[model samples]
Target: MDKKIVFITGVSRGIGLEIAKCFSNNGYFVLGTSRSDFDLAKVLSSDECLHIQLNVTDRNQISACLDQLKEIDKVPNVLINNAGITKDQLFLRMKNEDWDDVIETNLTSVFNMSKLFIKSMVKERSGSIINISSVAGLMGNAGQVNYSASKAGLGGFTRALAKEVAARNITVNCIAPGFIETDMTDHFQDKDLENILNQIPANKMGNPQHIADLALFLASSKGNYITGQTISVDGGLFMS
Candidate 1:
């Protein structure tokens, strides 16, 4: 049997990086992407894992990247849309560019990626596409209207696409994580951190591995029946 291939974006660090390592360690070939180049030696030590530079928001770049993957006969059996950005601001103070940037990077990029990869999966009659969303999209955050909107959009996208591809045995799902201990959440002020901690029943921020492990399950054979679901790995911060 051929080794399964998993393609992941925003893999330079954080949840994305951990996801890559998780799949690679499990004996899958991992194709990891980041907007900027990083040391592959540190990010993914295995030769089966390759790091590629890609800006997920750029449609042309996405197409080119897919074409390159084709040349290598390494089209992925799983695609994880894990690249995202946050521009936290009160709605009254938010700039249009900020909103656009967040939407493009977070939500629109998923559209681009899924469109490109779904055809191959459909033809193969099997695949998993896991999108990394946020708890803010479900519970909403005070100064993150843009971020919330983007993540919420992903939930809808995942459900609709799951239905579309279910007949083909292609599963689509979203994982909405709460305050994971990533660089994205490292900027909180002391008081703000205390307030956030007070709201969580777990009383602690989650690690990237928490999200990675969930992603691994969703991408594995164990998750074959799961589709159109937005699973939360937010340490009981927001219960649906």
Candidate 2:
């Protein structure tokens, strides 16, 4: 049997990298995209993995990446839209550029990528699209109006698209992670971090692997029946 293929965005570091490794280790052909000039030899020196420099905000780059995958005759069985950014500032003080930047990267990119890939999945009649959202999108956060809005848009996108593609046997889902320990969260102060921890019923920061595990499950056959859902992997921070 041919190995399943997965294409993940924002995979140079953090949760995206972890997810790529998880799928690769499990015998999936993994293609990872990062905007950075990543040393693929140093990071993912494996035949099962392909690393490409791609900026999700750039439409041409996204199209180019998809073209590269097509060249290999490996249409992705799963597409993880994990690329995102946060420009934290109060709504009143937020620059228009910051708002547009976040919307384009986090929200608009999902629309573009999903639209591009859905046709292939529809023809094959089997695929999964996992979107990485955030708990801030569910509960909302101060100084993160732009980031929260983008993530919230992801939730709506996942649900609506799931309905559109469900008849074709494609499942669309969103994973809203809470306070995972990554370079992005390293900027928090000790007290602020502790306070955030206290709010989590699990009383701990979630690891990137934790999110990766859930994503793998969703992509696997076990998750075939699931669609139009947003699952939170945030250590009980927000119970729905």
- Cα lDDT tens digits, model 2, 143-208, are 999999999999999999999999988899999999899998899999999999999999999999
For lDDT, the strongest prediction is 1
Task: Count the clashes in each prediction.
Answer: 0, 0
Cα lDDT computed for each candidate against the true fold: 0.91, 0.89
Assess every candidate by TM-score. 0.97, 0.96
lDDT of 1 by residue, 151-171 (tens): 999999999999999999888
Query: Could you give me the TM-score of model 2 versus the true structure?
Result: 0.96
| Structure candidate 2, residue pairs in collision | none
Candidate 1: global Cα-lDDT? Answer: 0.91
RMSD of each: 1.2, 1.4
Candidate 1, poorest ten consecutive residues by summed lDDT: 38-47
Off by over 4 Å in 1: 1-3
